[model samples]
Target: MQPSLAELQRALAARILAEEGSDLDDWICVPSEADSAARVAVYVQGYPARIREALRETFPAVAQILGDGSFAAFADRYAKDVPADLQNLNLVGAALPAYLESDRVSGDLPFLPALAELEWAVDRCFHAELLPPFAASACSGWSLDEWARARVGFQPGLALVCAPWPLRELRETYRCERSEIDVDLVDRHDQVLVYRRGFDVVVESIEAAEAEAVASLQCGDALGEVAAKLAGSGAEPAAVAGYFGRWASLGLVVSCEACPLP
Candidate 1:
C-alpha cells in the first residue's frame, strides 16, 4: 500500500535526519542519489559546529578546563541532544549542566558544568537590553509600613548562580591570562552573582546571605521578609542597606513596589 501524507512526511524527515549523519539512522539515500546527501550534510553538520563555536567563544574557561578533545566531544553530544532552538547562541549551553548530569555524558568534571552555567549567564547579561533606571527617590513616597510590604523585582539581566568552584574569579582571570592556564586546585564551592552594571558585566563574589536575599527579592518577596531573612543570618542591616543602594545604582533593581522613605 502507498504511504499516507503523514507517513511520507515522517519518512522524509527521517531521511533528512539520516542524511545529516544522525546516529538514529543507518543510511538515508542510496549511492544512486546525486549530490542530495552531500548537500544536506553541509547544513546538518553546520548546526552542531555553529553551536559548538558559539559555546567555545562564550565559555573559554570551560573549554580550557575540559581540554579541546573533551570539549568537542561533549559539545557534539550536547548538540545532538539539544538542537539549536534560540536565535541567541548565547543560550546554547544553558542546559549543559543537566546534560552532563545525565548518564550518557557523566564525567568527573562536576565543576565544569557549574563553570559553564556562570559563563553563559554572564554572557547573557552582557548582551541583555538595558532596563529602566531605578530611582532612589521612589523610596520617598512610601511609608515604613508600605515599604515593608513592598515586593521587589530584579533587573532582567541579573542572575544569581551558586557555583561549586570559583567560577566568577576563574572567568575574569582566564580572560586576562597571557598564554594559557593550568587548572590547579580550585575552591570547593562559591557564590557568584552576575549582573550588568552600566555597560560592563560586573561579577561579584557575594556571601550566601546576599545570594539568598537577592533570590528572595527576585521571587517577589516583600521587602520586610527579605530583610528579615538577611538579618536572621546575622548580616548587618546597615551593610545590607548599603549593598542594596549600590545594586540600585548599577541598574540591578528592576522595580521596588514599596519601600521606606530614604
Candidate 2:
C-alpha cells in the first residue's frame, strides 16, 4: 500500500531535518531511475541553508557581531534545536530572541538577547500592516472629563524594549557597512519605542516618564488612570500630552475609545 501525502511529507521532513532516514524512502516518490537519496540530500542541505539566510536577513546586527562563521554556526544550532515547521522563512526568527535568552549562547555578550529582541521587533514592525492613523481632531469635541476616561490604542506591531544597555546604539553600530566597529558597551537604562513609519521601521529612545505612560496605555489603562499613576510616580502626568502628540505625528496611535457606562 502507498503512503498518504501527509505521511510522505512527515517522512521527508524527518529525513531532511532529523536525519532519521529509515524507511522514509519507501514512502517517498515512486522509485525512479534517478538516485532518490541524492534528491533527499539536496533538501537536507537546502533546509538549513535557507533558514540560515533568513536568520542573517532578520538579524544582520547579530550576524555582524558573531562574524560569518560563528553566526552560521549559531544559526545552524538554533535551526536544528528548534524545528522550523512554518513554510515562511520570515517567521523563523520569531523565537530567536527567547532562544538566545534561554540558550545563553554567548557568555561574553550578555546583551545578545536584548539586541536580538530589538532586531526581531524591527523586522516584525516592518512586516506589520499599518492601519489608518488616529485623528487627534477626534478628541477636539470631547470635554476634559471625557478625555480622562479615554482608552488609547496603539498601532499594530508597536513594540517597547527596555534594557540596561543602549540597544539602539548597538544596532546602529552594525547597521552601516563599517570595516571596524568601535563599540562602547555602556551600561545604562535605555527605553526605546519601535514602530513602522511608512515603509520603514524606526527605533527611537524615549524618556522614562513617557515610557511609563506608554507602558500603562499598553496595559489597557485609561488615560486618566495612566495620568494618576504617572503623578504618583513623581512624573509629570501632563507630559503624556506631549508623548501623545509625538506618537500621533509618528502615526503610532490607531484608536481611542471612551469608558462604556452600564
Candidate 3:
C-alpha cells in the first residue's frame, strides 16, 4: 500500500535527522531518481547553516568566543536539539543559554550563553515597535495623591539582563573583523539595561539597585513602591524622580494610570 502524503512528510522529517545511510525501517523509501535522503540532507544542513549565519550576525561576541569552526558545530547541534518555532528568526536563539547549561557545551566559555542572551535581548529591543512618548507633564493635571497610585506602563522593548560578566562592554568592544583580541570572558559580573532609545537599541550597564527598580516597575508596582525600593538603596528621592522623568521622556513609560486623588 502507498504511504499517505502526511506519512511521507513525517518520514522525510525523521529521515533528515537520522545519521546518513542508516536504514531506519520506518523511513519513507527514496526513489532511485529522487534520492529523498539526499534531498532531506539538503534541508537539515541548511537549517543550521541559516541559523548560524543569523546568530553570528546577531551575537558577534559569541562568534568571537567560540571562533568559526567550533561556533558552527555548536550552532548545528543546537539547532538539532532545539527546533525553530517562531516566525521571526530573531527570537530563535532566546533559549540557547538555557539549553547550553544542561548540555555542558558552553563549559569552555562559561559565560558565553549569558552573553548570547544579552545580545539577543539587544537585537529584540532594537526591532520592537516604539510607542508614543510619555511625558511627566502629562500627569500635571493630577493631584499629588492621584499621582502616587498611578500604574505605569513601560515601552514595548525594555529588557533587563543579569549576568556574571560585563556583556554590554564585551559586546560593544567586539569586532568580528578584528585580527587581534584583548577582552577576557572570565569571572566578572555585569547587569544590563536594554531599551529602545529612539531609532536605536541601547545596551548599557546598570547597578543592581537600578535593575531592581526597573524590575519592580515592570511587575506593575506603583511608582511610590518603586521609589521606595530605589530610595532604600541610597538613591535620593529627587534623583529617583528625575530618573523616571527621563525615562518617561524617552518613551520608556508608554502610559500612566492614576488613582483617585484624596
Give me the candidate number with maximum TM-score.
Answer: 2
Better of 2 and 3 by lDDT: 2
Instruction: Order the candidates by TM-score, highest first.
Output: 2, 3, 1
Model 2 regions lying over 4 Å from their true place = 1-8, 24-39, 176-179
Candidate 1, residue 230: Cα displacement in angstroms equals 1.8
TM-score of every prediction relative to native: 0.77, 0.87, 0.83
lDDT for model 1: 0.71
The TM-score of candidate 1 is 0.77
Candidate 3 or 1, higher TM-score: 3
lDDT of each: 0.71, 0.85, 0.75
lDDT of 3: 0.75
Model 1: per-residue lDDT, tens digit, 57-120?
8878777666678778888877777755787876787787667667243367666667777887
How does residue 15 of candidate 1 score in lDDT? Answer: 48
Pairwise lDDT winner, candidates 1 and 2: 2
lDDT (Cα) of model 2: 0.85
Query: Which of candidates 2 and 3 reaches a greater TM-score?
Result: 2
1-262: candidate 3 lDDT, tens digit per residue:
7667776666556655644543344554567798765766777677677888887888788777677888888877887888788976777787776776765557766777777788888888888989887776778888755666877888888988888877776776566454565666576678888898777888878777667777887898777777777778787644546667777766788888875545
